[model samples]
Target: MFRTENALILREVRFKESDRILTALTADAGKMTLAAHGALSKHSRIAAATQQLTYAELTLFEKNGRYTVREGVTKEGFPGLRQDLGKLALGSYFAECLEQYAGEDQPEPELMQLGLNSLYALSEGLGSCEKIKAAFELRLMTLEGYAPAEESCPVCGRGDIREPVFLPEEGQTVCRACRKAGRSLPLTENALAAMRHILHAPAKKLLAFRLTEEEQSLLSAVAESWLLHCSDRNFPTLAYYRNLKL
Candidate 1:
């Protein structure tokens, strides 16, 4: 049977000489692998749409629980994301995060929207890369149902978080009165505000906030820590993104 879906190519691997295999996150089907015949060869229709970071509409032939691309139409290749090493690395990081969190055949529309919106922000140069990454990380977690408690300290119920402390593994914010020694990362008020904005803002306004360098650093730390603790795996793409000279 033939099944068509709108998807983002999260990963692509060369297969044999001219064929390629793609790991794609579909808007309706979650994540799945699609084989592109002759994608490496000249004059192949599916070639452009099969590249990593390309978002496309794919028509696939499925049998025995596997999918092969019959045709593909490119929607957004996010060209601007490739213009700079930093943006490219960050885009890869976002793709890797989606690959980890999205499941096969388990439709996650919100997550798909989050990924597409983030790529759009990056591709359009709408904000600082650090701000975009921080927003994406926090919002991705929130969409996955692991959002940090930002209204008050989970342990002490303290509403005043002038100096907020975030516990990554627990997915909670802690007040000074409830902080366990060595158990939290210090979050500046701006960092706290950034996270709140990411989780609560309108879809069009999620990346509307700005951050100072110091706040960006703190938010990056907390976001990365929470992602690592929740994912419990090393993301090489993220590591590479971090090591690049920004």
Candidate 2:
């Protein structure tokens, strides 16, 4: 059967000399591995759409349980990200995280939208790279049911947590007065506020908040630590992105 879907090309590998194997996150079907015949050829019509980090509308043929690309049209190539190595590395890291967390054969429209929005924001320079990275990390972890409780200090029941420290393992915050001896990342007021915004903001306004350089650094650390704790694994792409920053 033939069907068309909007998908983000998360990763691609060469399959033989001219064909390609694509790992795509579809709007309706979650993640899928697709065979794209001749997609790697210099003259292939679908080459642009099948490249990693490109969002495309693809015509796919499915037989039994496998899929093959029949046609593809690139919708957003994110040219701005391509022009900057740092942005591109960060975008690639996002793609890798999506591949790891997104479920196959499940409808994940929210996740799909988050991926598209993040890429669009990065491509358009709507926010700083660090801001975007922190937002995406926290939001994606929330979507996957690992959201940290930032509403208040879990220990004191204080709605306003002054001088908060984030506990990655506990997935919540505690006021400095209530913090116990454990692994924790201290959060500046702005960093804590940014985390709340990222966790609760609407998709369109997820990246609307701003932060000072120090605050951004703190937020990024909290976000990454939370994600790494919840996911329980490291991503090579993430390491590469960090290396690029350094």
Candidate 3:
């Protein structure tokens, strides 16, 4: 059987000497692993489309419950991301996040769209890497049904919140009174507004927010801790991105 779909190449690993294994996020089928023969060769047509972060239309042949890539035509490779190490690492981190949340044969179009939009923002330099990463993490958590409550402090129910503190493990924002309970980070009003925008902004307007350097750092801290707490695991690409001075 043959099937065709639009997919983004999240990862590519060499199979034998010439063939490659592709980890793709398909618009119609979510995540899938497809084998591409002769993909390592310089003359291979599918080479460009098989590279990580390549959004392409793929044709695959299936037999015995396995899918093999027959052809791939590239759509968007976000070439600008490749021009900078930081952007490339961030893009890789996005791919890894998608790989973790997406499941085989399950359609998650919103997640796919979010990933594509984030790559576009990185490619176009829409925002600073820290802002982009924080926004992506917060919004992604919301999409995965782990959004942090922002209405009031979950502990004190104080609606007029001042100097909010976020508890990552609890996925809640608390008032200043609750900060001493354990390891918690300050979530400034600006940072809280940023998270709120990420959780509620329209799809096309997701990357439109602006923030000061201080607010950006606060948001990054809260976002990183929240994502880490929710996932309960660290991603290698994220670790590398964090280590970079950029």
Candidate 4:
């Protein structure tokens, strides 16, 4: 059967000499692994659309539960990312996260939107890289049903946590008075406010808020730690991105 879908190419591996295998996140099919014949050849038509992080409309043929790309047209190649190594690394990290967490053969429109928005933000330089990273991490976790309770301290039921410290394992914030001995990252008031905004804001307004350098650092640390804890795996792309930043 032949069908069409809009998909983001998350990862690609060389198959044989000229063919390619792609891990794609589709708007309707969630995640799919697709085979693209001759994608590596110099004269291949679909090569550009099949590149990692390219968002494209793909014509696919499915048989025996396997998919092959018959045609592909790029929707948004995010050209700006390639010119800047930092943005490219961060964009690659986003792709890795989506490939890891998005469910296969399930519709995940919201997650798809988040991934697109994140890449667009990076490609367009819409916000500070740190801010974008923090927002994406927190929002992705929320979409996966692991949203942290930023509204109140879980232990004391206090809506106003003046001295907030985030517990990654528990996926919640607590007042310093209620903090225990496990891993906890302290949050400044600005960092806490940013976290709340990230969790509740709409897609377009996700990075609307501002933060000082110190506050951004705090938020970045919290967001990364929380996501790693919830996902229970470390991403090599994330490590590479961090190394690039350093």
Say which candidate scores most in TM-score: 2
Badly placed stretches (over 4 Å) of model 4 are none
lDDT of 1 by residue, 115-223 (tens): 9999989999998888888889888988888887899877766777758988876888887667886668888877788889888998789987778888888888898
Scored by CA lDDT, what does every candidate get?
Answer: 0.88, 0.92, 0.87, 0.93
TM-score of 2: 0.98
Q: What's the residue-level lDDT of 237 in candidate 1? A: 90
**Backbone clash total, candidate 3:** 0
Identify the runs in model 1 with alpha carbons over 4 angstroms from their true place. Answer: none
* RMSD (CA, angstroms), candidate 2: 0.9
Question: Candidate 1: worst 10 consecutive residues by lDDT?
Answer: 174-183
lDDT of 3 by residue, 12-87 (tens): 8988889989899987788999999998998999888888899999889999989888899999989999999989
Q: Can you write out model 2's per-residue Cα lDDT over 22-61, one digit (the tens) per residue? A: 9999879999999999998888999999999999999999
TM-score of 3: 0.96
Pairs in clash, predicted candidate 4: none
- How many residue pairs clash in all the candidates, one count each? 0, 0, 0, 0
Residue-level lDDT of model 4, residues 168-211, one tens digit each, is 88888999999989999989888999999999999889999898
lDDT of 1 at 117: 92
